[model samples]
Target chain A: MNRRAFLATTAAGAAVAAFPAILKAQGGDTIKVGFPGPTTGPFGALAKDQQQGASVAMEEINAKGGILGRRLEILFRDDQLKPAVGAQRTKELIENERCEFIVGGLAAHVQMAINEQTKKAGKLFISVSQSDEITARPDWGPLTFHEALNPTITSRAVGNWLAQNLGKKWWILYADYAWGKQNNAVLTEVLKRQGGVLLGSTPYPLGNPEFSAHLPKILAAKPEVLVTMTPGADNIAFLKQAISFGMKKEMKIAQPLHWLPQLKEGGPDLYADIYAGINFSWQLEDAIPEAKNYVALYRKKHNEPPGDYSAYAYSAIHEVARGITLAKVVNSDAVASALIANPVYNHYKGKQWWRACDHKAFQDLWIVKGRERSKMKGEWDFVDIVQKVAASEELDRSCKEKGFV
Target chain B: MAELTLATLAAQAFTGLVLGMILVLLAIGLSLIFGLMTVVNFAHGSLYMLGAYLGFFLIGYTKSFWLALVVAPLLVGALGFGIERFLVRPLYGRSIDDPLLLTFGLSLVMVETVRLIWGKIGLTLDPPRELAGAVNLGFTYFPLYRLFVIGVTVVVLVALFVFLEKTNVGLIIRAGSRDPLMVKALGFDLGRVWLLVFGIGTALAGLAGILAGPMRGVYAEMGVTIIIESFVVVVVGGMGSLVGAIVAGIAIGEVVSLTTLFAPKFAEIMVFIVMALVLLVRPSGLFGESGLME
Candidate 1:
């Protein structure tokens, strides 16, 4: 027993004693919200924007003395839009970081993987993006709630308007994957039932760089309207090439979804005359003061207005805080019930509730037209809100038909 | 007024040809690097992407696409020279595996570096106003920018041919690629040839990238996707054979274009299917001699 041995023994004992306290400090006593998304891939900007939105929510919530007397905190980890990375990061969020709930989602496959992990972990989950199958059967769980429109809801929201004005003869160009396939199917059902002709519904392979081969076939179909279901960068490429080919002047162009960043990236000249259905917009002028306040607060703090993902996070924090207040407990079951209770939780997204059957937040979607360069008032004023469709009127019963009573 | 008239096929044929021209430009660059160094430069695509970004910067600062078209390639070529000297020269004469592994890692590093600088969102350039509209080709309306793509390809290919067939430098490169040891034994400066070949190869890819910037909507991952198809074109045309590469590029482009008319989902995979079948029969490629890969 030398002096060196004694010193080594003391250091080992102290490390063992401090480990639990370190772990506890790492978890903290605050309410932790985890957000895992594509913070490094193509959609990285959107994820970073969502992180800012989540921060804004935490700021507003903590200013009011936090949620249930505990300070609210947000933890962001880049999922890189990889499904495996998403699952692993989320497991760390719950198991290690002690995140009580999860928010923010993008890319269907990534979100779908996170759904399985969240359900297994029994952590409350809310998706702020439009994931087609997150609430679908075999994948849908009691704890997961979708805050945006699904494929069916989006299809229904813009269905009638597209058929009536853009002509019933439709040609669809979509990425060949679950989300894209679901888009093709849902749009088909809605359009065909209204006596609309299905000219060509082409599933372009995912990550296909060139549309030279596909665009001509779309034209050969002679469709009165070309509905593009490819989201993000792919959507930009298709529209630009289509515009250069004079497709916009030949026939109307539309997408199931489009975002502010994309409109900016694609340029208004290329995006002109393109119609789309969306769950949220930054330019809500009339409705709730909180919604308006959130926009103003975000603009003041970040110097840019928030998009739908930002608004979703802002409202989600408010909803969670209310759930905690009513349930009087932080347990998953209590908050879950409180969130889906009788009167339904009404927040910034209008009268909305998590449909217990499908775990989807039933809400509204708007049809919008891309503004021409000449008609634009400002840089961001790129779209004209055409119509708003309520969820109550166009609820997709398919989720109920999938063995969910 | 019918959708499936003869006019449709004629339009598709032209579309495929334009797309093939883009492939020809991209694949020729890759083939030259492989032939000159025998180092499969996976970072070729990243260089192409750099061309697009460099073009965007030049266009933004100077407000001229013409300047970008001329300058982007030269800048990328200079960068390629630096890379070959420092990063690649050390790996030369090593096991083929070393350069392959290094270039693969370099591609990811370059892409991530670009992501850090540009952010992961995409950037797009608009075609000049003069090339914005479509020109009626009697049968159908054809985009003027796409036509410009074909015109640029022809000029590039002819220039490349003249450089190869009508110059002492071209003859030396062809001889060096065939028998480098022999060329070195004959007292030729093979090192300078290596530098020139790498620079010119990457410059061609950069030119293609800038041209595609308006069409593809430049992004970090944009290079990764197009590079795979370029590799496919390289293999199909006969590795190291420029004529083979160009012919295969056009052929595959037409096949991809026409196949979509019948089976849209199959059009993408059809390129690979043809590649696989071609390899089964002619492992050396359509225009490749058996020893050309060496």
Candidate 2:
């Protein structure tokens, strides 16, 4: 062989020999967490808030010498609010990006798809979206942890409050989807248990813009309260139209969740007199030290108050990091065991514990009434916290109902 | 269920009519562009969303919904003119798929642009103070803005009808759409006419957007849902026929509205069902002329 050819072959052999070490060094530098969210569609704002919250958690973790003596990193992928897209992105995150843990699913149905992929890969999936089914039957696994409040908890809290305050006759209007249906069923059950009269129920398509058509039926029923479960833009449209039709004069309006970003968009005037259940309110800073810290940190970064959904992502990231720290390893099984064993966390609010039976986080839920414009103290102060529903195992379905018994 | 009284029926009917008018406003723009240019402008919805955004900003600046109403459509029309001139005109002679794909991509780009400019957060636009409240119609209290929308739609429809029927420019546009080469040979600037028609079509979409902004808050993906429905309206109405668009738009609207009362689960699909039934009966649509499919 020629001299030059001999040198080239030697160089190629050395490069191949060094490649695995290089890959190991690169991989070991930081722990990657996969976050697939609906960052582009209707849920874009919420997804952005989640990303910001995750960033803050990442920063804090890295500053304290990240999990297992390695820096922590988050990889965000846009799911475009589609379940198929979410699943695909999650697969890419696990298989290609080599993310050992998964976080994020802004929409209810989309989160289930993400969970399925994470389950197949045997990676811990900390879902940040709400859905009763996420923790119940067929979907939950050893590695599945839900940080957001499920519909059952939200509905029961708000339902008990509405029953005691608002009159018995209630009409329901919900976006025809999994999340909406779940809230409707749970709320209906709670209300019926309290001897509430069911006026009627209307299920409109998701993302529906027109609610005027349903006004006649609602008017005819003359319900004392109108409970709507339309999420996001649909909720705003429904309320605006409902108010315009003078339905507010006849019946009070309430919902399972009051999204902070939405409250900002819809304004105080539109949301005034409406009641909703929420996970966190910025005003909690007055009483909760963690909330104050979180709101301050988030405001410093984003120049806005942290949304309720933001707390979910923030807590999920922190808890996952804590699990890694406790396990003293990057392995999924070790982290899962650590989290499941410990089972208690308080990232940005009151104490929340993970139910060993279902892996659902039991946290305090609040019922808030929208404050009128005259009573508002600031732009973000849209709702007044009226009642707190203490977190408990009873707020969730029994283990048997979860098919765990 | 409550008794379906005459009062209830009247309320439901008015609701249906309002929805129909909004659909009419949107679908007319889609119909006009297709009728005149045979360009399936998928970007029409983006243009509508643009109008809403522009109106939102204009209202912030000018503090006048009325001024935004007049100006936003014109701004959108100007944009349509540019889109037709620079982007669409070059693809005119290619496979019809060329323009369809281009416009589809344009829609995606436009949505992203809006997001970049306005951020992903949704924003609301309030109706003018005068039209903010409900009006008692005895049957039910209806939104004054909605009633205003109906009135504006009727006036706009009447004006459009007169323009299309009686004007020389409208005649030239009609002739050029049928036989572009013949019209070009007859010494008329067919390119300008096509551009104008595209502009007018998109401006109608813009008008619909601003009108809808108050009812439905302005957001990045606001157009994505309505665009599909507008296409359904156009197809069910007959691809390029104005009268067909009007009739199908209203019929589909009423179907959706009434279905909410009787069978809420089917409200979304009722439009598609109507479209299928119409196609099964008259493939060309209610008022469509023959041979466009060829």
lDDT of 1: 0.82
Going through the candidates in the order shown, the clash numbers are 0, 0
Worst 10-residue stretch by lDDT in candidate 2 chain A?
A: A60-69
After superposing candidate 1, which stretches have Cα over 4 Å from the reference?
A: A1-29, A287-290, B90-92
**Which ranges in model 2 have alpha carbons more than 4 Å from their true place?**
A1-36, A58-102, A117-122, A321-335, A338-341, B85-102, B170-192, B235-241
Cα-based TM-score, every candidate: 0.92, 0.88
RMSD of each: 3.9, 4.2
TM-score of chain B of each: 0.97, 0.98
Best by TM-score: 1
Tens-digit lDDT string for candidate 1 (A223-304): 9988888777888888878877778878888888877777877778877778998767777645655557778878888988
Instruction: Report lDDT (CA) for all predictions.
Output: 0.82, 0.89
Candidate 1, residue A395: Cα displacement in angstroms equals 2.6
